[model samples]
Target: MNKIVQIDPDQVEDVGPLYAARKKVYPQKVSGTFRRIKWGLMAFCLGIYYFLPFVRWNRGLAAPDQAVLIDLPNSRFYFFFIELWPQEVYYFTGLLILAAITLFLMNSVGGRIWCGYLCPQTVWTDLFYAVERLVEGDRRERMKKDASAHRWTLERISEFVLKHSIWLMIAWWTGGAWVLYFTDAPTLVKELVTFQAPAIAYIWIAILTATTYLLAGFMREQVCVYMCPWPRIQAALTDEWALNVTYRYDRGEKRMSVKKANDLRALGQHAGDCVDCYQCVAVCPVGIDIRNGPQLDCIQCGLCIDACDNVMKKINRPTRLIGYDNDINIQRRIEGKAPIYRIVRPRTIIYAALIALVGGIMLYTLATRSLLDINVLHDRNPVAVKLSDGSIRNAYTVRFLNKRGFDRVVAIDIDGPQDAKLHVVGGDSITPDRPMIVLGRDGTTELRVLVTAPSDRNPEKSIPVKFRVTDIGLGEVASATDNFVAP
Candidate 1:
């Protein structure tokens, strides 16, 4: 037997709506250890991104001299000394695998370090913030200016114009730098400056310029918070052992003003180090309070740590009221136990091992990769033809690749069907037994080939045929197989 239960409508739980309004963040400027580190990393990353394409490499007369190039017209990719053809796209797969594992390893060690210190979004946003700080002012001034109803003063208007102009210049250059990787950087620059570059280049520059301006200038932290998937992915990837930007709530609780804390300390009562100052929140790019515990919006950028350290110093209190720490350590501290770190734990070890294995395999394969390759496609329309002398013949389209740097004579041979003879459509055989053609260095050659065998000696229907191309000088051999059919 079951009893019926009734509830009042007024007692029902009310779930909140899904969406929230956006809040504009005006982060203050602060200087300390993390700020200096961010400055160094920003310089390094931006310098490399803008200038690397201009670097030159000496790859003989036949190849482009750019150190890094994506030769779309020629279907080639050149990175320093390594040249990859379209057929070798697996190298890119290996590279992506390596990148993913490295990111996982980074997340395991330190939460969102990539997002905080090294992400393009963070770097460019930081740069844009610096520009804003330069043109307008620090937190207090900017906040005041924004709050004022009449902010359209001449000085403010001029500052805004100047700031946006600089931003546009930087964004345009960023876009211009991208197109340089596809061609010779110096030549592209010259053409671009003279307004004589390809229309496509200008179109790409416009697109990237708009995106850079909008993302770095306007969107800023929104990109990391709402747009990028990495934040959500890293949230799932993070473990208790990973260090992140954290507030030491254990030391920071029982918050009060500095005067109140000093008086309580003088009275010999429990007084936490936090002065309830909002410095940590003030310097945050994402405008979230660290004291509210870990939030998905926090990028673990460590700027708040710098801000809190500065505040602690000014107040003559201990530093690191906010710092890089893990929840396990925080819990251990609360439990009156020493914190233990296990950077070499199982997950890290596994990720490291896999990275090593994949990296080693890629390196080994690259070192031992063949310099020559061949492909043979047997004709299908007329699979086999009856020749004048009663010999059964099969036609094939053979493609040869010469990965070397100089021209060479390559000999082609056929293996299948008894007493089969090979003939290249336009070539005279170097020897009566094999046909030979000249292969250009670092290029591909396609040619039609015919194979004939005595009709009386032909197999029932089809016989497996192998096409062998040999570099006559280097003695290197490459082979492909197809079926030789009887007419």
Candidate 2:
């Protein structure tokens, strides 16, 4: 049996509405180990992003001098000495697989480490927050200024202008740097400075600049909390053994003032280490309280850990009130057992093995990839024609690609039918069976080819024909297959 008491909308009104306005958070800065790590990672990531385009790679005189390029106009991708054609898009597939497995490995060891530290959104937002703090002061002062008339003063306005100008400059530079990766960096730089760069380049720069500015400068934490899907996906992927930035309530509960706790200890009464300082809450970039456990809103930035550690040091208590600890260790500590970490568990091992295996295959294939290729398309409409001399004729369209930087002499050959003679409509066959052609480096040649065979040996429906392309100088080879049809 169930019981229903009463309906009372007015009664709940005195207790206030279900929802209330959210309070803005102003995070204070603290220097600690995690803070230092964030700084180092930020430098490495930003340095690579901003300056890597200037790095050079040599591909001899036949290729673009730039070390890295996307060469969209030419339908090629160049990475230093390595060049990839459209047919090799499978390399991107292998790379994506490696990336996914790497993410899994990272999550197996530490939950959402990518989200907290390395994600573009997080990194950019962290940088923006640093700028904000420098211009507006830390938590308390910023809050006071926001609540007071001082927010509109000339000094504050000047700071706002200076900060945004710098932000726009960084955003523009980021967009400009992206364009360099698509073309010769030195040449692009010269063209861009002279306002003679392609119109598409300017258009892309403007779009990226606006997006970066709005996302990092204004949208900020909103992107992490509501826009990205990784938080939810990572939550599902994480295990209980994974180390996450967490508040150790076992050591930090039953909050009280430091003086009260000291007096309590003197009286032989048990007391927690926390002084209820709210330092952890104050330093959060996404404005989540660590004491509440793992919530989606928490970016796991470790600022809270640093804040709590600072408090612990000042109060002469043990540190790591908030630290990277797993639930298994937390439970073990509660049960009076020493905590243990297992970073090399079965899942981590499997992820590592798969990454190494796939990466090795990709590397090997890339190193030994051939520089020439061919494709053949048999005429589908007519299929085959009856020759006047009691022979069968088949037509084919053949395409030859020479990936080298200069022109090359190539010989084409076909083998399938006996007494079949090959002829290129506007080209030449070296022998009655082999066709010789010239292919331009980094270019393609198309030929209309005809094959005639004595009707006796030809198969009734279709028979396989292999078109082989042989590079004369390098002895490199590529081939494609099609079928010769007969009525």
Candidate 3:
């Protein structure tokens, strides 16, 4: 039998708060292969974003000349040579799928490569940090300034103002560049400067500006840790084989000073290379100690690797105390075996294959897509009408899409019951039985059409009716099928 004992109320310990206040992180600047790579990528990304709007593509007269534009008013999306109508929204869907698969493939090979190297947040935040470092000084200087009791000195005030001003300018330009993609870039720029641009454009610019300033300038790593869903997603997607910014504990355990490590090694005792300098933590953008093992907060940006490598070089130890490595390699090193890498594994292969397949399909469809199209909608109120001449008639609204750069004449014809007479309400026939209509350049035109069948030939049940529109000059053809019903 067990005896039940009652605990005193005072003996119970108080529980700690569930949430902790955010600590300000001041990431130090470091330079290495990864840092150079990041700088190159940031420049490339920003250059394309800020300047691509000004690039022009010759799409004939009366068409948008901007290389990339989202002509929302005209319900069109243009990218260099490709033009997409609203009906081709599936292309966007395919693009989204391709992006997701590429991200997965990157994650499967190297953990959070997108978050580390190419994420807009990471790039912008890095830029903001650079501005901060330039204005306020490096990690130690900034920390000393912030920690001082006299927080409002003249020099400090000037630094704060300068840093924030630069940040705001960058944010504003980022917003401005986004709006340029929606219209004629040079015209919009002039209108914007003259204060004659549309209110909606200014409103969007303001919204984006505020968000970019807040997220990149102040939120910084908090955006990566608590806000972005990709970190959590990549955490789940990462595998043991994936290379992450990791500390090789096998070589860096038993942290001690360089002098002590040297003495131990000389005495024929084991001494790990790590010196516990905290440089890795100092240079981390997310303020995580990679030595503490993989955490969700670690973006795997590899700055810590640079810091550790620098330290190792100074201490006369082998570099890469922290490097792009996996748990499997760490274990293999501990077991006195050579490290192995598997970049071409099953998951990565699958992701690559899927991306290729989707990309191929989209390219093929775009290349072979029809320039002319038609859609037919049957009249609802009266499905069929009985004419005075003992004939059955069906009315339809036919919409013709001419996706060409110039106006074209198209002849329309209908095929249904034998001896069917086709008539366009406001159009004249270029031929005896086919009505011809002029289609505007890269536009849609709708017409009311009537198809009449003789009473003797009219079907008792609804039958299929096909409408064909043929371009008179190019001989391009498009067709739509509806139904012909008896009165």
Per-candidate local distance difference test: 0.90, 0.85, 0.92
Query: Tens digit of lDDT per residue, candidate 3, span 202-298?
Result: 9999999999999999999999999999988888888899988889999999999999999999999999899999999999998888888989998
Compute the lDDT for candidate 3: 0.92
The sequence of per-residue lDDT tens digits that candidate 2 reaches over residues 1-487 is 8998997876675766676445566778888988898888998998888888888877766678777789998999987777888999999999899999999889889888888889988787788778889888888877888899657899889888988988888889889899889888888889999999999999999998899999888877778877898888889988888899988888887789999999999999978898888888888887888898989988787888899999999999999988999878888888999999998888888999999999999999988888798889889888899988789999999888888888888887777888788889987555545677778778888899898888888756778888888888889889988887786
How much is the lDDT of residue 447 in candidate 1? Answer: 88
Clashing residue pairs in candidate 2 are: none
Candidate 3 residues lying further than 4 Å off, grouped into runs, are 1-12
Which pairs of residues clash in candidate 3, taking residues 3 or more apart in a chain or in different chains? none
By summed lDDT, the worst window of 10 consecutive residues in model 3 runs over: 426-435
The lDDT-based order of candidates, best leading, equals 3, 1, 2
RMSD of 1: 3.7
Q: What is the lDDT of candidate 2?
A: 0.85
Expressed as tens digits, the lDDT of each residue in 1-487 for candidate 1 is 8998999989999876687777889999999999999999999999999999999999887778999999999899999999999999999999999999999999999888898899999998899999999999998999899999999999999999999999999999999999988989999999988999999999999999999999999999888888999988998888988888889988888898899999998999978888878989999999999989989999989999999999999889999989888888888999999978888999999999999999999999999888899999989989899889988988889889987778889888878889988888876556756677888888998888889899788756888889888889889999998998887
RMSD list, candidates in order: 3.7, 3.7, 2.7
User: Where does the lowest 10-residue lDDT sum fall in candidate 1?
Assistant: 426-435
Predicted model with the maximum lDDT: 3
